[model samples]
Target: MPHRPNTPCRHPGCANLVPYGQQYCETHKLLHPEALRSAGSRGYGSRWQRESKAYLRAHPLCAECARQGKYTKATVVDHIKPHRGDPALFWDRANWQPLCKPCHDKKTWNEDKNPVYSY
Candidate 1:
C-alpha cells in the first residue's frame, strides 16, 4: 500500500493539513467557542439537535455521568453553564455535554430553581 499526502484544511487561514474532504483540522472542526452563543439563533436548532443525537449515539456514555460510573443512555446535550445569560457559550462544544435523561432532569430542575432562559 502507498502512503497518501495529507491535504491542507479548508477553513480559511488554517495551515494544518487534514484528510481529504474535511473542511477543518481536528481542532477547528467543531464550532468555535464564541460562535456557540448565537448558533441557535443563527438557525441551527434542529440541525444541532440531530448532531447532538449522533454524537451521543456514537459515544453513548454520558460524559459526566460516565465519570461517576453511571451507565444510562445519554439523551441530552447540556450546557455546563446556562446559555441564556452567556449566549456566547451556546455553540461551544466544550460547553456542551452528553447527559442521561435522569441527570438531565435533575439539571433542569436545578435550573428551574435559578430560572435562567437560553432561548
Candidate 2:
C-alpha cells in the first residue's frame, strides 16, 4: 500500500506540511483550541438540546428566510452573537434566533471565515 502525501498546514502563511487528514501542523494546531473540543464540551449538551428544541418550537420560521419573504422551517437555534464558550451569552434567550440549516450554515461559515476582531 502507498502512503498518502503530506498536506500544507491550514494556517495562513504557514509553510509546514502535515499528514493527510490533519488540518494543521503541530505549531499551528494549538492556535485553534475550539477545534479540539467536542460539541458537548462546547456547551451543546443535553440541556442545550432541550432548550434549543423548545426555542425552535416557539420560533418555527427561519428569521433570515422570513426577512426574504419565505416561510422556511427552522431546524437550528443560532446565537445572533456567537457565544464563544461564554456561559452568559450561551444561555441568553434574547441573543438567540431561529434559522433553517442552510441559513445557519451560511451564517456560521461567514462568521468563521471573516471573524470580527474586538480590540
Candidate 3:
C-alpha cells in the first residue's frame, strides 16, 4: 500500500493541510472568481474606480478646458486614449484629463469608453 504525502495550506495563519497546488484551505478557498483577477484588469470593479476618483479630486480642474481659460469644474477623469486593449494606461496621469460632468459624458460618448466619472 502507498500513502499520499500531506501538504500544508498556503493561507496565512492556516495550519490545515491541503492537496498540492492548493494555496488556501478548503474553507478559505471558496473565494469569488472575480476576486482572483488582478485589479489592473478592466471590469475588476470599484476598487480601481475609487482610486481614480481620488486622483481626479487631487487635480480638480479641466486640463483641456482650462488651457483655453475656461474654468470647468472637473467631476470626471478621462483617458486621452482608449484603455480597452491597454489596461496599463489606466493609471497614467499623463493620459488623464479632468472635465465637468456634461463635458465628460459627451466626451465619453464621443471618445473612448475609458472615462472614469468622479462626481
Which candidate number maximizes lDDT? 2
lDDT by residue for model 2 (1-119), tens:
99999999877678899999888788977776677788999999999999999999999999999999999999999999998779999999999999999999999998877755454
lDDT of 3 by residue, 1-119 (tens): 76676788654556999776556676756542323456555543687588668878798888768878998778777777756546578667788777878777777666422333333
Q: RMSD to native for every prediction?
A: 15.4, 2.0, 15.4
Off by over 4 Å in 1: 1-44, 85-87, 116-119
lDDT of 1 by residue, 1-119 (tens): 87677898755567999776555677865633333346666545897778787777777777768788767778888887766544478667778888887888898778744543233
Runs of candidate 3 exceeding 4 Å displacement: 1-41, 112-119
**Scored by Cα lDDT, where does model 2 land?**
0.91
Instruction: Estimate the TM-score of every prediction.
Output: 0.52, 0.86, 0.50
**Which candidate has the top score in TM-score?**
2
Candidate order by decreasing lDDT: 2, 1, 3
Error of 2 at 48 (Å): 0.5
How well does candidate 3 match the true structure in TM-score terms?
Answer: 0.50
Q: Is candidate 1 or candidate 2 better by lDDT?
A: 2
